[model samples]
Target: MKEYKISLPICENDIDTLQAGDYVYLTGTVYTARDAAHLRMYEAAGRGEDLPFDIKGSVIYYLGPSPAREGQVIGSAGPTTSGRMDKYTPTLLDMGLKAMIGKGRRSPEVIESMKKNGAVYFAAVGGAGALLSKCIKSAEVIAYDDLGTEAIRKLYVEDLPVITVIDREGNNLYDSV
Candidate 1:
């Protein structure tokens, strides 16, 4: 496996060099979205409505952070099960979403969409919420704030660690393990 340092609003060239099992340290913007947020986005797209954020070249992390404590930018922010968003995944990929960060396996259809779209999938280590939050430099709810922790947050992150669970070519690290 290789290790790479990449910035967000990722382009196809940046993702082309990656392989499943490669380690990545991402710096730049990433939007947080869980199941509720995904459903909303998907529905919005279906209606040909504008999304809260631009979908092109964006990375979406499936996270629901807890309320922050004093002096903290964010609270424990960990990945949620990715499979829950499988139904919405393909459409998002088609809409120009560059990558996704979460845990667990993805459906075959989603993997195929990733291959077709030249996107990648990264996995944040589960149960490492506190450690992960340290990478987030700033966070603010951009939409769906009523969902609280499930809100879509615009976050600025630096050196946020993740592994390439599935690369653009439909290569899956989980398959070999």
Candidate 2:
């Protein structure tokens, strides 16, 4: 498997180097946002309200994990179904999101948006809770604390394994798989 290590707000060089099926070990800061957070973000965008965080080149991980165990940075943090975020994805992409990390297939509209905006979709292993959680070195909630697991969090990770599911060129590994 081909491997890459990148920081967030990934640039064109990072996106261009990746292709469908490439394995990635993302480091640096990534913001976590799920269905609730996505909804709030879309709503804010509709109301002309500034987002809680900048969306440019941001990688949003779709997850709602169990509380971290003692002495652990995070708990059972794995990708939730990507479909849940489909409705909100295009809007975010239009708003300048460059990368999204989740699992499973995304809708055609989302795929189209990725192609149109030079964005990429990545897939983490499904149900690999224990394995996935170990990659997170630090975790702290940055927004929507009341939403619990659905809240936005800033995660500092190292070698977080993922596969390129959809490339900016509109290649989808899922269909070929």
Residues 63-123 of candidate 2 have per-residue lDDT tens digits of 8888988898999999999899999999999999999889999999999999899999999
Output the number of the lDDT-best candidate: 1
Q: Which candidate achieves the best TM-score against the true structure? A: 1
Question: Per-prediction TM-score, please?
Answer: 0.98, 0.96
Clashes of 1: 0
User: What lDDT does model 1 reach?
Assistant: 0.95
lDDT of 2: 0.90
Pairs that collide in candidate 1 are none
lDDT of 1 by residue, 12-91 (tens): 78899999999999999999999999999999999999888998999999999999999999999989999999999999
How many residue pairs of model 2 clash at the backbone?
0
